[model samples]
Target: MNTETNILNILGEQIKLGERKEVNFDVANLHTASAINVPIIIERSKKPGPTVLFTAGIHGDEVNGVEIVRQLIAKGINKPKSGTVICMPIINIFGFINLKREFPDGRDLNRVFPGSKNGSLASRVAHKLITEIVPHADYIIDFHTGSSGRFNAPQLRIVKHNQQLRGLAKVFGAPFVLYSKNLNKSFRTVCNKLGKPLLLFEGGKSFHIDNIVTNTGVNGAKRILFYLGMLSSKFKVSTPKKDCVFIEESKWIRAKLSGMFKASVKINAKVEKGDLLGNITDPYGKMNYFVKADYSGYIINVNESPVVYQGDALFHITKKLIR
Candidate 1:
């Protein structure tokens, strides 16, 4: 992976060693006929090393992930010490403009990986990204967040039994490491098929930017670069507050009935069997149903919406842990 080529050809532009360039990843025009050009910020060091790609905003509403990548660029963190660093702070500009998750045509961009050039609008963009940008990255870190109202604790999601990813995730030092299967046609799956090592980060929630989540993401990126000998000396990497908990299996706790929901337990908290997690109550205070833990485990996600209907997910708890 570390061939250390002097020139990198990406998106029809050649970036030489030690050169900094911002390339436009043009896909399609907006409804107003304005050209949509997603900026790809590339920074190369005079010394050669592995190329790292930091991407966010695959789902436009995941602002926390975008903020993390933005801070990397704004603080010159993308300026590597050795190798190259590419930052695509926002991928879905259409959905970003509308403050939505999917593309303007209502297609989930993540579901159309290794896309066809002559397919739908989202597919074209995905195809361009896979063909033009992704091939150049030696390591990829795609940031994301929980969908809907569920807030995910800062975590790195990797497939089970990948020793390489396990080591990398440990070095990244997030609060949690979740072993999950890759979704079909997901970016991670396509990258894996192409033999690129990618780390999928999940934290916070859509449309919300929490400072802690942002810092965790940024710090994790720095740690990864440092481990790869790409991070500049100016940045100081901090050790995680706690050892990352490796969750092997997890389950969602759902609401039994419709009501005003309030969580008494915080996210990432450990709970015992039958512990009071929260309560679901009728608006008129006629009926208050106490929500308790069915099994003891760490709460990885908590639904924050005030109102919830029957069968709405209330919490994500770990079912099993890996020692």
Candidate 2:
């Protein structure tokens, strides 16, 4: 991730210190040969510091993440006091354009990392990202949202026992820090392999934007920048309203019967065993089944969809906490 004191080369462009550049990360053209532009916004200070990269919209439907990164640029937060701040607000331009989560071919861009140049369209983009962009990043913060109709409390996800990540997660100061393993072939895994520190933020749900979630994400980014001495002088970092809850383990509560669903509780709600979390009912009103927490814990995720099928995850509850 090292770069020269005077020059930073990204996507075949040489950006000097104190220079600003908006480079397009173009991969392909549309069927009509219309070129798609994936803009990479870069800001560099004359003084030397760490290069932090902010990214979002790997999944097209995850608009909340996109909004957070957009706020950073629009607010001039990406202009660091020292070093460089890179923003690629939308990576999967195909999905972002089509309003789908995956590539036009239905492949998850995240699942194909360190991609091949000669591979599928998604793979080529991955390859370009890993090869062309990621090498310049000393730190990376990737934003994401819950899939389908699941609403997630603002949180950071990192594997357990990595002290570097553990400290950075605390610095980011999201509401919750969940210890999860890096999935193989994922963006996190690839970045980890390349020795780039990454903080993965998950909030809200797909195809939706929440103001609170957006603020949490934006504030967390500012905190990290402040910690790194990269935040501009004009921006003020806010103290987290509460201490981060470190979840050591968690489990998903699944639906026992398929039916109309309604959650009685909200995300981040702490519940006791047997507490009524929600209920399911037949459309005809002939049957109603109360959903209760099987064990005492905090709810990190709640399925917000009105209708669900049997065995669908209803809630994600914490099983253990890091004291």
Clashes of each: 0, 0
lDDT of model number 2: 0.94
Task: List, residue by residue over 89-189, the lDDT tens digit for candidate 2.
Answer: 99999999888999988899999998999999999999999999998899999999999999999999999889999999888889999999999899999
Candidate with top lDDT is: 2
Candidate 2 displacement at residue 225 in angstroms: 0.5
Scored by lDDT, model 1 comes in at 0.93
Output the lDDT of residue 8, model 1: 90
The alpha-carbon lDDT assigned to residue 136 of candidate 1 equals 88
lDDT of 1 by residue, 1-323 (tens): 95468999888899999999999988888889998778999999999899999999999899999999999999999999899999999998888989999998899999999889999989998998899988888999999999898999999999999999999999999999999999999999999999999999999999999998999999999999999988899899899999889999999999999999999999889999999999999989899999999999999999999999999999999999987
TM-score, every prediction: 0.99, 0.99
Error of 1 at 196 (Å): 0.6
44 in model 2: Cα distance from truth in Å? 0.4
Worst 10 residues of 1 by lDDT: 2-11
